[model samples]
Target: MDLVNSFLNFVVPPASLLMLAFSWPTLSFINVCEWIYDTYFREIDMDNKVAVITGASSGIGEQIAYEYAKRGANLVLVARRDTRLRGIAENARRLGSRNVLIMAADVVKEDDCRRFITEAINFYGRVDHLVNTASLGHTFFFEEATDPSVFPILLDINFWGNIYPTYVALPYLRQTKGRIVVNASVENWLPLPRMSLYAAAKAALINFYETLRFEVKDNVGITIATHGWIGTEMARGRFMVEEGAEMQWKEEREVHVTGGPVEEFAKLIVDGACRGNAYVKYPSWYDVFFVFRVFAPNILYWTLQMLSTNHVVRRTSYIGTGRPLYLEGSPPRKFLTAGPSTQVPVQQQLKME
Candidate 1:
């Protein structure tokens, strides 16, 4: 490996320069033509379409339900919180949707994911789009981790959570030549401090879908949505510790919120998914930073270091005070809540009333 690296070090730079010189114009032209094609030919119709959305209880997911509802699409909303899901479904109906189904399921569980997708198909008859918008975020430095063992929760929820739903819904989606929209984050490709595991999961998500896109080869459309900061429940819900290794989750409090509105972000995401866009970067400005990440990594690293300082309030456990409990492989922690809840199948949390 060392010898291969040494050889590449000697040859890659010149070869890259030559390749860039020869391919730049062709690549630029192709990009221009692709943009034109997408702009003029791409069309997305939401009326009467059956759409399945995970993480539909709150944040961008909740707003996405409303946006799709406004377009007259039938929706199946999934989340761990049945109460919140019910509320969002009601709002979606008021927005314009004639039919809305709320299914409480954890995306990380294969069976739960299967049930969610199966229930959606059973209700709608055909599925036009499956939106994977479920994710979790943390803001602690790696060194302060009390139990690095608990880090897998991050990957399981963010990466595997997206994958499980896509896997189960693929067959139904293929029937309609349907689309899959994944809510990845800009942190996947960019340098961001204190979010190492979250970024890794997102990066994995991006790579997985990118590869899946070619494997499906026009059979199923895949749209990867990459977003930066947004004003949402996750933004204001911060974490704090009482003492050594004992983690305490804090209440949602606004402490310098920065980002675009979740509602607008949701609209853009829906529009992009329906248009079959390969990628969507929110706030538009994230594109510039993404470019800098590739070409000017050092500068990007320094900037992110500065940006992460605000999160370094104190040293606390990585997993938090909540004892890591995977109830039948599902974490005991409440979904999107700092407080813990009793063991129950997430799918049964719904109340039709």
Candidate 2:
């Protein structure tokens, strides 16, 4: 058995490389065909369909809600901030969503997830799409954690926060042959510094949904979106810091947030979900790095290290400097407290009840 195993191992790598080389052109042609069909021919009517989006208060999630609304989809926006959700719901109504329900609930807790899913079913009668966009970002090195207790919340929010809702919504999604849109990160595969836990959690998320896709098959479609840096609060350095730690990195904002706008990313995500795509990546150029990671990992690691070493040595993060960080005019808070400006009148608010 050992001899056979060794023989297979010796043959597999070269054989796999040969197969890949032979198949590359065919695969590329097939992908181009699929892209063409999805772009010009295929269309999934979202008019009046229900889409439930978590982390809908801000960032990519918030923009996705708006994009869905523009497609005439009814929206269920969930977050811990009811005020922000309310404001977003108003804008969604104006954007052409016939109904917009706002629910304030923490995604980390199983009970909260179940409650919101139940409420969404009751309000919409069906959930055609479950978009899991709830996540937290971490910008400190793993070893620099002053409070190790905070580590679990990172996993809980990034992994379980997306899982619990999917678990509860899967049956309903199956009934409608619906789709699940995940807002993951490129850090899942890209070795970015100061994001050890965040990257690990995102990697778990990508794997979970990929496996789930096989089990569910055609009954439910899963669109795993791995995005690069976008202009979100997280990119603005709003990360989960230890107790009394803050994030004040005004000078570094440009360095961290340089990517496509959140609005463009959201539009692409919604379009891909409607087309039943398996994966969507923003700044799609990031896909190139995956080849480097697979074929030449040491090179990838060295390149990333070289690029990040200067920033790492600066030690401006919360754990590095041991000082509260916030933009000069902004409050010293980690989360978004103020709601977005509502252009629609209060009377125009959509009430599910």
Candidate 3:
């Protein structure tokens, strides 16, 4: 496509080719939307449909909850903080959602998972959708990181986190032929050097959801979003950045990765979920890279290492802070309090809740 786009760019203007490419995708999407409304939504109803979402307290999860609620989805928002969960539930109710049940259970617990899903079934009597967007993403060089021992902990949240929910919800999903949207990260493809843990966990999620779609093909539909970075709390919280690591958010002289706005990204996610898509990728550029990383590993990784901030950069101080490249202050979320939940630390809150 790049080569074709280049040839067209030389003949006409690059802008013209971009416009042509953009026009076709929009029309194709409309066709899919029509098919979905006819096959599922019109046949059923979403006015008070039920959706169970993990990691609903902040970042992408919160936005997804907002997007679904806007469409009248009765949400079961799961996260660990009682305060944050309650705040999100209230805001969702105000957003025109008919019912919003707040479940302050940390999905990391198996018992919590079974109970949460059971209650969701009893409360709304059906689950129309399930979105798994939770993960613990502290990464470092496998050897240098003391957190190497933390892999099981991360997996418990990232992998088992979605597993138990799917298990309990599956019987219901099979009944309703509900949709499942699992949030996998872009690193599932472009594995960054020091971001080993995050990449591995996300990769596992990708494989699980991909296979899951086929497993439940006759019943529920599945969509795996290999998301790129977005402007969310995960992006804002800088503590996770390792000292001297070359992150995408670093200065021009430093290494860094580019990202998209959170709401915009979340909107695309909702659109795909509504349509029951199989895969959803963003910034749209990474689609080709995902393929390249598979077929041309050597050249792709070598060249990307230069353009991307995947560690191995010249040594520097570990001082972490990024001057707001965009604007300061959180954007207004109508009736929404957007940030990490502070009612309790994730570990303690999950257990308490």
TM-score of each model, in listed order: 0.78, 0.84, 0.71
Predicted candidate 1 versus true structure: per-residue lDDT over 1-353, tens digit per residue: 99999999888867876787899899989978977887779868889999999988778888899989999999999987788788788899999999999997888889999997888878889999999988877766666555554477677878998999999999998999999999988888886666777888889999999999999999999998888778776674432222222221222334556667888888888888877888887866777776567555789888877876865554332343233222122344443212354533221110000
Candidate 1 weakest ten by summed lDDT:
344-353
Descending-lDDT candidate ranking? 2, 1, 3
User: After superposition, which runs of candidate 3 have C-alpha atoms over 4 Å from their true positions?
Assistant: 1-45, 238-258, 308-353
lDDT of 2 at 81: 67
Q: Which candidate wins on lDDT?
A: 2
Q: Which candidate is the best by TM-score?
A: 2
Clashing pairs in 1: 247-321
Pitting candidate 2 against candidate 3, the one with the higher TM-score is 2
Predictions in order: lDDT? 0.75, 0.77, 0.67
Clashes of 2: 4
Better of 1 and 2 by lDDT: 2
Model 2 over residues 58-118: C-alpha lDDT tens digits?
7788899999999999999998768878889999999999999988887877899889889
Cα lDDT over the full model 1: 0.75
30-135, model 3: which lDDT tens digit per residue?
9688767745664334578898999888778888899888888899999865677888888888887988888878687788988889999888899989998876
